[model samples]
Target: MFKSLLISALFVLSSQVIAATATNIAESAEQVSPLLPGLAVPNIELKDQYGKTVSLAERFKEKTTVLIVYRGGWCPYCSKQLANVQKIEKELADLGAQIIAVSPDSPEKLAESKITSPNYQLLSDDSLLLAQKLGLAFYLDDKTAKIYRNKLGVNFVSLEGEVKVALPVPAVFVIDTNGLVNFQYANPNYKVRLTEDLLLAAVKSVSEQ
Candidate 1:
């Protein structure tokens, strides 16, 4: 366990070095990335935990949608954020909003995240197609990648592999039915995620339109 914790810390430090110029993202469970805000939200088609095809515009037809993208279930912070948002889902819906969470975790791993986050829709960005298209993907260097695998046992290979490519740093954006982003929450630090209260405010504000 100590080794794992150390590995996780080292992993975070590595991510920080890479995201230094843009945003300072970190590790998870309850960790939130500090990647700064971006300009737009692109159309993306990922999968649900059930391996069913999902498209943003289609699911959110004629309604407001919130896109909350994360690294994967590896972090504890993501779980907390997901659970919190789900708890206040009613508050969000009251403002005429729908929400979807995205991650690069394959359906199998995403299914594990879904087991913990059963309420919200978990979209799988297995190929990270949208992240790459949106310029949100970042490749992990060797030293850092080694820590995630040799130390933390992150298990990305079962889904993809360590030598794969970049993963999407955690990010959140609220998009209106028109498919334009109204608000965004991004950070490179994995420890910091947007609070549910703040997200609720964004929903309320946008719904007034």
Candidate 2:
């Protein structure tokens, strides 16, 4: 009876912590405080492009991970960045690193995005749960959200059908097999991104450590 009570108490505490984190999401992209180097990457489970659950921690355990957080498939800048990464996917793999891209698109949308490459994995974070936990989630302003939905035809629905108006500031994190972030780069400007050359250099540096 005591052990069961302890388990229930721990569960409730964790739920409260997550709720607190969710409530603290930044109001704008510029205000987001992305996770920094030396911090342990959050071990959250997110749906892959095929709707299969993939754990961030499990992926980290396999090898060094290059985690790319993008706004969505609807963003041209995001697409370009993904393509640039593809060009150096082999180089990264040769250095014993793997790449994983996460975005606020559902599994179906992820499939439609056609951003997949054989060398890397794409995961869906429609609810922005992982982003929030990493301090990288921000609420899109009403005007921008409306423009995206009405003009751009970008669907904001989550996997459970609820609308999500949050996006992750475009960021890249190099995390080691132990899940410790080795380097990070995040910028609120949607048009600007870390270059493929810099990303490859970052991965190479992490692999040596």
Candidate 3:
């Protein structure tokens, strides 16, 4: 009887340890990706350069959408990426893909950041509603925020004149007509970007499928 009881107690202790480890693993895995491919993306509302409200889902219905989320126009990296995207705009359109660039910039700042093409829609996410829904928004450190406002002259403020609280992770998502994410590129490093060649390849794959 004593031996049997010891075995039973050991088994119970092992089971408890296993359960605790499993719970820890699950909690650790909760650091979700900002955007996951093969999932339906957030259908958040945004405004165009002209301040006209637009629905992301509505755009998906018309064609395959290449969604580019960037920092504000003040970032040279973002500006270069925008220009590169414009160069590939026609080719993507031929494949029934449209590029929409969304930034945390206000509509007024968006106007200043125009890429000189009506085909590429520059949308504003000043409220960060879309970013938060996608799990991509992160708050900057107080020191960095102060530098952006003071030295950089970027003044990361929303249209409502509230100081900027959060910024989206620079990312690109290729959405299918069904509003599902087909491909995505997200980088925590601000200087890096998804190459146009890779973007074209993703679009081609979607088009063929």
TM-score of each: 0.71, 0.83, 0.78
Worst 10 residues of 3 by lDDT: 21-30
Model 3: lDDT to the true structure: 0.77
Model 1, position 9, has a per-residue lDDT of 100
TM-score result, candidate 1: 0.71
Q: Give the better candidate number (1 or 2) by lDDT.
A: 2
Worst 10 residues of 2 by lDDT: 153-162
Candidate lDDT (C-alpha), each: 0.68, 0.84, 0.77
| Highest-scoring model, TM-score | 2
RMSD of each: 12.4, 6.1, 11.5
C-alpha lDDT of residue 154 in model 2 = 48
Candidate 3 residue-wise lDDT, 87-206, digit = tens:
889999999998888887888878886575756888988766676666666656567767776755442423223345356778898999999989988787778999999999999999
CA lDDT of 25 in candidate 3? Answer: 9
Model 1, span 13-130: residue lDDT tens: 8777555434222232224323233344556778887798887767666577778887777768887887778888877777878778887777878777534433357888766666
Whole-model lDDT, model 1: 0.68
* Sequence-dependent TM-score of model 3: 0.78
Candidate 2 lDDT, 68-125, residue by residue in tens: 9988887889999998898888999999999999988889888886656655998988
Once model 1 is optimally superposed onto the true structure by TM-score, how far is the C-alpha of residue 198 displaced, in angstroms? 1.2
**Candidate 1 segments whose C-alpha is farther than 4 A from its true place:** 1-40, 114-119, 151-165
